[model samples]
Target: MDLALKKQILQKAQDWFVESIAQNHIKNTEKLIKPTEFKINPFTAVYLANFLTGNSNPESIAKALVYPRVLGTSITTSFGTNIQKFTSEVLSAFGSTTSGIDIEFIDQLDGFKKYCQMKSGPETINKDDVETIAKHFSGVLNLAKTNSLRIAHSDMIVGVLYGDSGDLNAHYKRITSEYHFPVYDLSPELVPFS
Candidate 1:
């Protein structure tokens, strides 16, 4: 990525991390949640990135106090999921028009609009997960036909980004080989799957 674009992504991701911490709320406080060994908070990820890129700022550390761990593992996991999805959506805007099954830009450069399913890492997927994904695609296909949207079967792709480094690349390759859909590993250059 270009320097300007990379900087923009980092800034936006950090902003998102702060906002997420401030607004975090659990619907069910009654439910017990045990803290896990994993420290997967987005703020932590952002801090790591900032450290690696030599972009450290006091604001990043000051906001760390608000990093919600009240719900422990549940809160951390939820925040991680939110940030990953948010980052992926923002990144997608740099190139493609990411959307649901509502419409399709048929005459675009790629000839057809793409529907992407993004994953944070090379985490294991079960058979049921695969089946559920297939069902989701089938639903979207049906929805597209019902709405008279122009799309092609070949426009669908599975995108894997930010994963655990040791296994991230391997996971990406495994996922791509396991499924028929084309997969793109868009993990940042410095951190493959942080």
Candidate 2:
């Protein structure tokens, strides 16, 4: 990947983290928590909805919500779990129902199948692929889904920032090594705070 492209993607990922934290804080406020309706960026909404509703088929939803920089490529299973947990925490903080927030990959695939079938697209997902992806992410997803209710809702900002930082560090290391470039520290100056 071009250095500029990589930097841009990294920045976008960071921005999401900041936004997630902000949203988390807003949800935590007692006044905001009781509101029945709210708005989120369309992309965030998709992930939030999936986590809250536990939609199994996320391909279409993913397609709709995935920031282009993170699309198509395989993400470590841990990232998936983090996202599920993050979504659940955010919803819970806002006093939204989380009955469907469990991150069962099989269920997500089932939903993806239904979505793909309805959209007049080739069925690009297969059981093997789902299993492979799920295997990669199962640990994180399982932990997040199972322990979601136990997480302190007040930690949303810290949790999201920590998760995003880890992922960005990993991505930076991967790209630097892949391109044989000297790894530069991701100084705060290089990334936007918001």
Name the 10 consecutive residues with the lowest summed lDDT in model 1.
Answer: 99-108
The whole-model lDDT of each prediction reads: 0.50, 0.33
Name the top TM-score candidate: 1
| Per-residue C-alpha lDDT of model 1 across residues 19-125, encoded as one tens digit per residue | 66435544433232323423456677568546645554655433332333344555656665674446444454333343432112232345556565656555644
User: Per-residue CA lDDT of candidate 2, range 1-194, in tens?
Assistant: 46876686567556655666445444443233222424436666666557755662655444334433232222322244345444334322222222222321111212220000000011222334333333333443455569773332211111122222334333233322432222211222222112
Query: How many clashes does each candidate structure show, in the order listed?
Result: 1, 6
Question: Highest lDDT: which candidate?
Answer: 1
> How big is the positional error of residue 84 in model 1, measured in Å on the Cα after superposition?
7.1
